[model samples]
Target: MAIRRALISVSDKTGIVEFARELAAAGVQIISTGGTHSLLEKEGIPVIGISEVTGFPEIMDGRVKTLHPAVHSGLLAVRDNEEHQRAIRELGLDYIDLVVVNLYPFAATIAKPDVTYEDAIENIDIGGPTMLRSAAKNHAFVTVVVDAADYEGVLGEIKQGGDTSLDTRKRLAAKVFRHTGAYDALIGDYLSKLGGDPLPERYTVTYEKVQDLRYGENPHQRAAFYRRPLASEGNVTTAEQLHGKELSYNNINDANAALAIVKEFSEPAVVAVKHMNPCGVGVGADIHEAYQKAYAADPTSIFGGIVAANRMIGEETAQLLSEIFLEIILAPDYTPEALDILSRKKNIRLLRTGELASAEGRKSDWVVTSVEGGMVVQESDVHSISEADLKVVTERQPTAEEMKQLLFGWKVVKHVKSNAILLAKDDRTVGVGAGQMNRVGAARIAIEQAGEQAKGAALASDAFFPMGDTVELAAKAGITAIIQPGGSIKDEESIRAANEHGIAMVFTGVRHFKH
Candidate 1:
């Protein structure tokens, strides 16, 4: 079909002027409204106002405009159908060959720090989406353009032959639908969140693709990274890769996990992660000492793991890290000597994430997991278990030093996958068992790894003990103190086991089950 009339309306006026001018120069009539009309006319591009086409003034803050038969019938009419053509002629409605529209800045408006509900509602576009949907639905005869990025190619196709190919039109139509879907999803998500609804009647989420990874968790799997438009501060989603290769899917996931765990500490801390669980974590007087303790915790698992540091990486830490085979190293800042030493590894990815902040005391958010047919959304288990939150459940009370280790192990266990167990001593994790089928299994792994080190260490379980077996096993492995969420019906059995072995056990009453 030959192009004759085109409508242009956009809130993002990116390349609209030059695009509209090209359309006008190509002998196509241009119809525009509001800001677009003013912009095109100011640029000396001949344009017909929407009021002229609809034979009605824009009313109700321009909301009543473009909802007329003149726009929709023209866009929806099928050219080859004789009845459709006859109906348009009888109604004196001209066919709109192309529609170029972008919606209101609802997302931007809501992103403002102090935006009100009324301000956000007013920015919702009605006419723009109506025209876009109408034209895109009839893409076989009418072309639709929603993104400014497509302007050059669309204008080129029109300039060459006054017609866009069916394939191009179809692609553009798909883009229009996707754009509108994301726009509406953002609106829905923002409104639902503002209303303080934990789980709305409908869940709507929109993400912009960041990049396609070289591979997923495995080489054969394909994967991509996406981010929410309004990403919060100090998240791995906003991390900047300072050096080395593009991140693989596993690298991104592991790095994110490492970052989150490291941020849990307020002191000089370091965490090494593998397969979404921390292999080693430590807090020390300095960054170098933290790295040394963390590396010593699990040397084998630290190989090829993603490492994160809460403090700036000094030369000594950099030199030590360079000795290992790491996939990624992240820090808020790195000394010049440290960067120079680490950059020698050709394949290692270095990221500079500025000032990792603890989410403590913030409004808790949701953690979503996808099932086969649906998703499970629940409040994030960001709850922490400090010394004050613990209740001494055993007859023997924990010593001051044991209490400190117990709190440290408690924080580490929260980041581990469910059925998790962590053994800690002197503010450093000696061993961690994650994502095991049973609590006893996790306990065995952690205790065996700790071996002689477990003699005076504290053990933290992510959840309540199902039976006395784990406590018995810990006692035999020489674990002196234990911390867990105590709510299981068989809690008495575990408490009896602890008391029998003279082990100090504390219950936080708060569970941290990560999966």
Candidate 2:
């Protein structure tokens, strides 16, 4: 299997002239099509056009070129078989020792801001993939190259001996099929999106590796981060780490959780997350007041947590944050004085992401979780309930101030792990009970945390109370009002308990389970 003839066709023409010159100097005949032939000819290299090799004119906008029997018979012929060689000799087809091809820029074309459907469809290459597949299938005798990066290495192998080794040929063949498969997947995804079907019968997504983390959630596991391309919005995956060491797996998870919760509020807000659950959330007139309220919510739980702010962080907020040992501080931007103050803590990771989008403008609406052998995908819990959406179910109606506190707590409760309960006073979370197995257990934990502060505070439950026990306990803990979905079978019993204890209760008509 000597280097008798090679075909070259590509959309990206990097380092092709030098590699082709080496091949031609070694007595290898170069066969090219269209742009590649013109490029090689201008570079003073001898080449043969594809039409000459196929003995037919390229027709139909050059879509029918290199699809004839002459090209396929040469690429698919088995060099070691005497019968195959005899058929090749009788058909007068020269042996194609190599195939160099890359598909059209379908992905980049579709990513254009104003690309049309007809333009995308026209960029799909037919003859290139066909020729690559033919050469790859007969890789035991033919060499196929899809990536320009492999051009020099391929030339090195050919110059070492008369042909590329069997092992290298097999590896290159595998690369050809992989390239074609990804190209086809991109086309399928683009077409399916045009048809208004986000989820097709078969779904395929592509991601590029961003970085390797220090480890997974634990020290014994390995992990890496990847992100989807062509994303225009800023998120945790799109955030820029301005200072400190590389982020850990748990750091990224908690940061993302904090960012999501902070994005729910329009006012200046701060959310502190621990173990992927919001331990503290506060919204105020400014970021300094927001940070102060959030830190006052649960100082112990905020020790090693991640904090995110929806507004620019100031010097006072940074100085207060420096008192705690936080893993990361994320914000839309930080003042020069604030950055100077926070820079004192060398290990604290600082992330500067752009402003958070509104609830309606958020992009991450799909949730994915993995099981043992597969994954479950569903829409995200971006549910929002307005003030008018709440229905008063008890004899006593919540005051306007209590309703505001309840809404603040409700926003924080949705980010907590279920069964969840959050107690808020003055637009800041005072206590949170998350990841409990029962409703009453979660309520007790939150009440115990609030103690004297629970008096006159509003309670927000992520889901409905299963029985009157939670209401009875909340009444004993001095909780003045409660807000829940009110869809439980024992809703009447809970309402009666609320009325007996003189506690005002409202139903949101929607649940915010976050398990």
Candidate 3:
């Protein structure tokens, strides 16, 4: 199985020159097309042009080259079949032993901020993918290379035995299909998006593998991380780990939850997350004050929790954070002294978020969840409310201070699991009750967590109270103000209970249920 001929065509010519030179030195005749042909000839390497094999010139802006029967038969011809051998001898078809190719930069072209439709369409490689798939389909006789990273291993195998092993060819062939599948999916996604149908009847999206994690949520399961190519700034996937051990499945999930909550505020803010739910949240004049408030929000739960901040972590803030055991600390940046102090801890993951300012508050569009047999994709919850948006549904109007706390609590409650309740005091969360079976049960848990802090705290519920029970519970805890989406059949009962307890209640006519 000695190698005699190879086809080399690529858009990403990282090691093409050296690889071609080595292949030619091994007595393998190289056939190339377009830019690849010019490059090999310029490098003083022996080569044969594609037109020389196909007996036709490149036409239609080089789109019709290498698409002739000669290239396909060379790549797909069977070496062991007598009939195929007769066709190869009588019809003068040659057998290609190897295919070195990579698709055009369709993903990169669309990623550009101002990329045009014509530019993107022109970059799609037709012949490259065709040759790759043809050779990949006949993996028993031909070897295919798609990634530049595989160059060394393929070259070593060829140098040793003059051909790739069956296992190597199969693996490379699998990679070729994945590469082409992602390429085609992206092109389809772009066309659908341009046609003003982002989530078409057949929804398709593409992601690239980031890394393999140690385990899944549990030690018994395996896991890996994949990143969406067009993900915006400040996403957990874009975080640059500065210090710590590798992130686990739970760590990435919790960090993403924390980032979602922190991204809601324009001011200096911090959010603590555990088990994909916000345990504590705070907003203040500076990062230090925000950190202090967040730590005090749920001191017991904050231990080993994921924390995300919108502002830079200063030395003072870092000093306080270093005093505790946290799984991860994420922020836009950190001071030199702050990094030095935090880096001293061996296991805490410190991530510096990149380019949050340019995100322009376009947080996300689609939210996806995985079920057993399939997945669920829906539009993300980007709802926000202001003072003007609140309806005075109770007898008492919320005071100025109570109104501020209500708004803060509302934002935090949105990120919590429903049935959710959050109690806020001043500029920080005092307690959060999430994932309960009923509204009253959730309020009781929130009140218990707040303890004495619940007396003056304002409460925000993710949904409307079914009856007066949750309102009565909040009243007993001395909650001064309440905010929720008010559209339940028993809304009057809750309003009566609030009025009886002299509590101010406002409704935004909107719900924030996170299931």
lDDT of all predictions: 0.90, 0.89, 0.91
Give the residue spans of candidate 2 off by over 4 A: 1-4, 14-29, 36-47, 148-152, 155-172, 314-316, 335-344
RMSD for each model, in Å, please? 1.7, 3.0, 1.4
**Highest-scoring model, TM-score:** 3
lDDT, model 1: 0.90
Candidate 3, superposed: residue stretches over 4 Å from native: 357-360
lDDT of 2: 0.89
Quantify how close model 1 is to the true structure by its C-alpha RMSD in Å. 1.7
Which one wins by TM-score: 1 or 2? 1
> Mind giving the per-residue lDDT tens digits that candidate 2 earns over 1-515?
68889999988899899989999999999999999999999999999999998899989988889999999999998888899889988988888999999888887888898998899999999999999999999999999999998998899988989799999999999988877887887788678867987677776666666899989989999999876655555578888888899988888889989988998898999999999998888888999999988988888999999999999898999999999899999999999999999989989999999878856566545466779987777778888878899999999999999999998888889989999999999888888999999989999999998888899999999999989999999999899999999998999999999999999999999998887
Per-model TM values vs. the true structure: 0.96, 0.88, 0.98
Flag the better candidate by TM-score, 1 or 3.
3
lDDT of 3 by residue, 1-515 (tens): 87799999999999999999999998999999999899999999999999999999999989999999888988888889988888888988789999999988988898899999999999988999999999999999999999989989988999999998999999999999998988988899889878988888887777898899999999999999999887776778988999999899999989988887888888889988889988788899998999899998898899989998899999999999999999999999999999999999998999999645422365448877889997899888877878999999998999999999999999889989999999999899998899999988899899999999999899999999999999888989999999999999999999999999999999989999999
Q: Sorted on TM-score, highest at the top, how do the candidates line up?
A: 3, 1, 2
